[model samples]
Target: MSPVEPFSDDSPLGASGAEGVRALRVAVTRPLSGERLENLLRDAGHAPVHFPLTRIEAPSDPRPLARGARALLRGEMDVLLLTSVRAVRSLAQALETVAEGPWRRPEGLQVWVIGDATGAAAARMGLVPDRIPEHFVAEQLLEEASSWARLDGLRILFPRAAAGRSLLPETLARAGATVTLVEAYRSVDDGEEADRLVRAMGRGELDLVTLTAGSQARVLARAMRGTRPALRCAVPMVAIGPATRMAMVAAGLPEPTVAAPHTVEGVVAAVKTVAGGLQ
Candidate 1:
């Protein structure tokens, strides 16, 4: 699915146009070779290196997630918060297992997604989001969600990975919302792929690395443990959002060029801008 939104303007550095990207060897962090994220890079005229840092796995126990799906279908939850496209898919899987017939939007369930990609995924499952923020960041979501609806005393069902940033749920809890988190999936670091990334970096074959999450930065750092710190600091990188930028820094990697609009298209623009500077 081409969840990537098209940017109307020229690349800020003037790289993407009729001629395509500037032949930059950009390293896309996830979504594999055939996904739209990689295709977006290829269609832009950039050579995108596949770097799968994390793989989504079914949780050790799937019962909780299944129960969450039932709750969603029954309209027992007042609000639904979806942050990633994977979460949407996992929830949908659960729904398919318990659903007796065609998927229908549960009445009275106000769906809220973090980004256009997540929202699109939700819609594909017949779940329409009631609110979406202009910015995709979780912090921004918390800040902007105030204008949407009464968050206090609401039962928010959030089906997410086993481990993730706790800011959203924690803040919602503080806001007096009883948030029930169901581990719909597990985001595990791929050790083999991380090793390959390290070798590529040592060989100086990578022009730049693109990171989509703080978790990716942590995984990259772990994989590059024995390498000289200079190697990591030297390689150009771009973070998909501010939270990721901070995670990169905390993990001892260089601060990356934070992508604006926090989308694949924005990452491409950042790569073009970085490539222009490199030239």
Candidate 2:
């Protein structure tokens, strides 16, 4: 397969001119779960190489997700917050297990997604998100949730990664919402991929690295230190948002050029902006 392909008309970046945009050898630390983002990067004239960092899978202990599913079916959950598309799919499996049949979302329960991508995932499962944050970030989700006066006495179910931060649940509790945080999935680093990334860095093949999740940032740091001598390549990092950027910084990596609007298109724009400025 070609390392880079021409952007298609269906791609969001199709209409965007690719001329004069310096295409960097960008390293994406996650597998291509969706090709939209990668297409956008290519549309903006970048060669994106996927060096998978973490693999997403169902959690070992499924009881927490099962209970959350039961709560929803019992009409006890007022709102369901999904941070990632994987969470939505995992929750769907848990729901099927709990219901012992095809799961139908209970009426009167609101669904909130982190962004358009998650919303699209929910849509595939016959769900329509009640709310999508203006900014695709957890902080914005909390802000949006807090704006709804009815949340003061509501029950919210959040099924996310096992290592997810407690900020969402804690913030909701402070706002008087009863929140149930369930571990629906586990995101663990792929050691083989990590080694490959370190090797690539050692060969000085990557020009820019994009980290979308904090966990990915942590994994990348571990990979950089995988060799006896650390692979201290000076490639610029591009974080999808502030949280990921913070994680990268905390791991002693260089501060990243954060993507604004927090979307695939946004990342393309951010990279183009950086590239344009360098000329």
Candidate 3:
């Protein structure tokens, strides 16, 4: 007998297995290095395809970040919101460049993270957050933080990428908090990889496509717009969060299978469950 397939011999939705045998193929669009998502897909007997859509680049001018580091050390901001681990790592590195000794974080500083993974990243830098919003999106974080009356006079520092929407900063400002938005990095579109992904989709060599951010989903949509074949078939789009899912919908894609908790593990689990159901 042939090797037993790990994926269930199931049909698409309510269809019968004899109608068609579903083969799993996953497209990874993020700049992930580990084998975590790939391993999960392979465990479900899916073909994992990696095509990074964006690349993270450090800021050319480190002077502003260095200044921010000094301010952070002096406890200039009452609250620090860390959105991604990459940002935290970059900020820590910038701080180390100008900081002396063991590098101690500000005392009495309130830190808030979007999620557990981001919180873990902050912890790695010896900065424990005082609060972590349940929802991992900017709007949710704003809503949750806005309920605190103590934030009235607080100065919040948000270090993130140069591009992207300004909803978070705007919301915080409306809630009576002085927000200082700092750019720590930038995300550049990898046109070469985007072209490759478009080709793969056109040839029907790709199956599942995972999007971690709204910007990435939009980028993929733009790439698909120029591809002949990708514009015809409706490929499965898996989003990491509600914001990404909304972005996918806005980009003219159907509602995607959304991951809960908006973490890497959540994304993997959601993909496995959906792929297994489609098998």
Q: Which candidate is the best by lDDT?
A: 1
Local distance difference test values of all predictions, in order:
0.82, 0.78, 0.75
Q: Sorted by lDDT, highest first, which candidate order results?
A: 1, 2, 3
User: Which portions of model 2 show Cα errors greater than 4 Å?
Assistant: 1-17, 226-233
Candidate 3 per-residue C-alpha lDDT over 215-276 given as tens digits, one digit per residue, 9 for 90 to 100? 78877878777555535355677899988899888987667889986876788777766656
Cα shift from native, residue 256, model 2 (Å)? 0.8
Clashes per candidate (backbone, < 3 Å): 1, 0, 1
Candidate 2, 204-241: lDDT as tens digits:
77666788888888887876764544445366678888
**RMSD, one per candidate, in order:** 5.4, 4.6, 5.5
In model 2, state the lDDT of residue 68: 91
User: lDDT by residue for model 1 over 1-279, one digit each (tens)?
Assistant: 112122324443335532543556667678455688778877766767787888778988999998888888888899999999999999988889999667677788899999899999999888888889888989888998778777788999999989988999999999888899999888888777778877777876677899998778899988988888788877799999898999999988887898887988888888878877776
Arranged by TM-score with the best first, the candidates are 1, 2, 3
Q: What is the alpha-carbon lDDT for the whole of candidate 1? A: 0.82
* Number of the top TM-score candidate: 1
- Work out the TM-score per prediction: 0.91, 0.86, 0.86
Where does model 3 exceed 4 Å of error? 1-23, 42-45, 228-233
User: How many residue pairs of model 3 clash at the backbone?
Assistant: 1
